[model samples]
Target: MSERVDLWNNGNLVQDIFLGEIKVPVKVLRNDSFQAWYLLQPRENGNKSSKTDDLGSLRLNICYTEDCVLPSEYYTSLRNLLLKSSDVQPISASAAYILSEVCRDKYDAVLPLVRLLLHHQKLVPFVAAVAELDLKDTQEANTIFRGNSLATRCVDEMMKIVGKHYLKVTLKPVIDEICESPKPCEIDPIKLKEGDNVEINMENLRYYVDKVFREIVRSSISCPTLMCDVFYSLRHLAAKRFPNDPHVQYSAVSSFVFLRFFAVAVVSPHTFHLRPHHPDAQTSRTLTLISKAIQTLGSWGSLNKTKLSSFKETFMCEFFKTFQEDTFTESVKKFLDDVSSTESKEPSGVSEPVHLKEGEMYKRAQGRTRIGKKNFKKRWFCLTSREFTYHKQQDKEPIFTIPIKNILAVEKLDESSFNKKNMFQVLHGEKPLYIQANNCVEASEWIEALCRVTRCNQKRLSFYHPSAFLNGNWLCCKATAESTEGCARCTADVPADTQIEIDGDRETERIYSLFTINRSKLQKLEEACGSIAVYQGPRKEPDDYSNFTIEDSVATFHTLQQIIDIVEKLNESHEKYQKKRSSSAKYGSEENPIVGKVS
Candidate 1:
């Protein structure tokens, strides 16, 4: 029961008009799959007497067949079969391989397969095996792991799922800064604004590329250990496959990390939650220039100077020439070495500070016991990944230090509170620190920076008074009590840490369902395996197992027989379970809710 709204003006939700919604019972998803046009209805508890206009229906396709997973014992047979995938000789014949072959799309099969194997700590061997097979099919050393094979998709999915936090802590601050305080970095001659100098724009683009690149390389320690392990496997397997090429291993890791991970993040920062929304036209051009430069720099090892010629625009080629130094190449190599290491990639507990925002601003002192105009003093303010601090002067210290974790909320101050034009407040456990920026843009920039960094803080507020607490009361809400809850709800409360937990049993069950749907194709695959095993003459031009890759026929046939047996047994168990469910839940109730086309 939620409404989607437009995110604009520093992640603030504005013009949030009410829309229709659909309410489906939780139990309706228990062991049932449905596709229906659920009619839209008015908000149930919203103002009852209000005459709401009619909203249209919505087509929903639900895949939640199991609301809760069965106990561990129920999944034992399926679990054992998946765990022994590597041991099954000629990995192409294994259940995992069969799933990849029969499914129309590789991703549908790869998701469940990767989760199951990774969950049991048996992923590397299978990935290496598939990658080796993929390499044998390739003649050129340059094109390894470029195709969307099972091995490639598995690693791609793994990086995205595991590296959620890595992307956030590494790039979010820079992305926020770029979006908030935008400068003209558009270098194209046709696209330049009136005062946009080509050299200045190029320098700005380079500065951003350097900042993002530095953060990425130095933050390898934050890379998830699982990602490092998978990358290590890809690196070794690729080097083993192409023993002549000295740089194949770097390409193997960079193919996914830089080309897929960092480059894509830079191009579309909002998708990664680095930006609150898509950047304006000029900002987007800046990001595109930066992203293109990064992609080339990251590809330093494999392609060498060859990829520089791949740039389209004449200025782009010129702009990219700045990164030809050996230092940039070395940085890419070092980053690859760090990320693909087999050792523990854990953080050292001491957080390094990456600067987010800074400027001189007027701060009204938190005179909790007293209030006066003399407390307002100009101070040098600074923000970083760890803490926010301000000093008496640009070079002087001995002022204030507020940990970012304790920042409760930051909002604009009531203009009437201090008769100031560009004022805002930093709310924490103590009294609010009211500050006045030089202008509106700087004010919004500071607010956006603080809010983005502390978004994941557990103690962050859901609401805040948009005005100042002055003269013993909140000016905006006119609330006399200091602790009274805020009248205005807070915006920009997106969760800090993304949770992408994969249930092992549920994934195993999903694999089972995929197998059940393509059972006939599975039968054909088995027959093809048998034919390839027994036939010893001139093979047919269009062979039986041509659709599926059969590396070793006898081995594949043996594995397929075991798979068919397990699926049949599971099928019987499912039938018995279905009978029990239908008998017990004939009448729809809370235990087995029924959902259908609504009035």
Candidate 2:
């Protein structure tokens, strides 16, 4: 008889028993319907005694067929039999149920067995059972499977049972615990040392380095230095470890921590002014780490030749803006200026330094202009009663002033012409007021006469700048108030009622005329004729005051001549008038000779 392995229910009956021939290999198949094992003879035919020596006898596998339907009582009996086995055995009853359910494609039964294993503190076995068999409805079942309800649960239980913790902390908490634990087994750092003998116990070094590296890097922030060391360790320990495990490889690839730390320590501070002196220290440390990582990665002999290339590419790309904008360009300019000025270093033949315009560099206090440029002065002006005075750009305090003399003749330009050049050239083209004074005597008389006609300032004598001639020339004159012996025929066609400008450049000028035409008499004459129909015909022949129906050139001419006579009288006898005014209580005396003919 061969040795028999029997598993029984609490009812003292064999639920599943294994028996084979002592001399020959015997195959066994369990019949679920009978809850008994059936011996299926092996392929080799030999005497029973020789079966004991057959190597195939020890390699037995139990199989169940699809058509063999087991009673529910038999499944229950099998479960009780496994549970009744000795406690020292690591065999799982839940695993048995899970296996049977999987072979039968019973997902509903498998989920319950998963729950039973979760209850028995066998989380790894339960997870293994779930992983070993493909359940049609695994996702639906896992929704209800919370992890073990304790903080100190094993890594296997904590990872699966409380998947929420991993999701919440992003697995950082677990990685931190693995690193921070005092136990040597928690994280074996020796395997990650740079100079471990790799050929002897090669598997142990690779295994320990990979295992420690995996847990360390799952969350890098908790143990950044350790993360760097493990990667360096792997680089030295085995060529096989590079490239494929980038999660570990990238973390181990030296520069990873330096890049991340640089972003926070250097980049964040310079951009946001986040940290003080501490950030400076961190920056130095980061640069050192980065250099080491680059050197180490460059020395590697593996497919991750691209890893070294990619590290450089990624570092350059990630920090390009910071290095170029914030650090390299600005600092280089500062350093060049400092060295060139202080040390008196001669320029190299390679390249000359370029200068910057104002408001270019950030270092010289925000919103300020840079070192060198000329300061521009504001233009200044002053106004006088007779004229406007402005400093010429070439002249200093003593300004070259301009006076708006008598407005030659005020005239408005056509609206079309005014719109085209905006009246800027109007002053340069034609003088506004035009007039002539007899001598010094006639000039004073006419000045008063103009006050009556225009009703403007009584004493001021000036025209808007550049519009009137300071020298009182005929061509500069716009129109005439009275005739002057020197230039009597000078005449200009001036439009009426155009506005004049007087500011900074010009003073307000009091207008004085040598003659005044009575508006009422002119209106009466136009009314008698139906129209002052000058320029009525298609050819637009010239018309004069003589064309009126009244037909009194003498009356028209006399009216104008009387006004002129009054001005002349005043001009000729100003001293007499002045003397009489000094003597009289009233200005227009009854005996005043010039007053009687004027009215």
lDDT of 1 by residue, 273-367 (tens): 77655566567767878888778788746334676687778788878777778777887887787678643222222245767788899998885
Q: After superposing candidate 1, which stretches have Cα over 4 Å from the reference? A: 3-69, 190-196, 302-307, 343-500, 594-599
lDDT score for candidate 1 against the true structure: 0.75
Off by over 4 Å in 2: 1-110, 125-160, 171-303, 306-599
Clashing pairs in 1: none
Q: After superposition, how far is residue 535 of candidate 2 from its true place, in Å?
A: 99
Cα-based lDDT for every prediction: 0.75, 0.28
Task: Give lDDT tens digits, candidate 2, residues 1-599.
Answer: 33333221222331222223223223333232323333433223232322423422333344543221122332332333323322212222222321331232333233333333333334333333332222212233211112221111222222232222212233233223322341222112232345544343233323333333233223221221112222333222222333343233222232222222222222233222222211222233332333333233222132232433444445333322222223222322232222112111112221332211111110111112222122112233332323323343323452423332332322222223112111111121222322222243433333322221221212222233322222233233443331222222211111111111222101000000101123343344334333333333444554443333233333333333333344344344545555655577454654333433454
Which 10 consecutive residues of model 2 have the lowest summed lDDT?
505-514
- Residue 179 in model 1: lDDT: 80
Strongest candidate by lDDT = 1
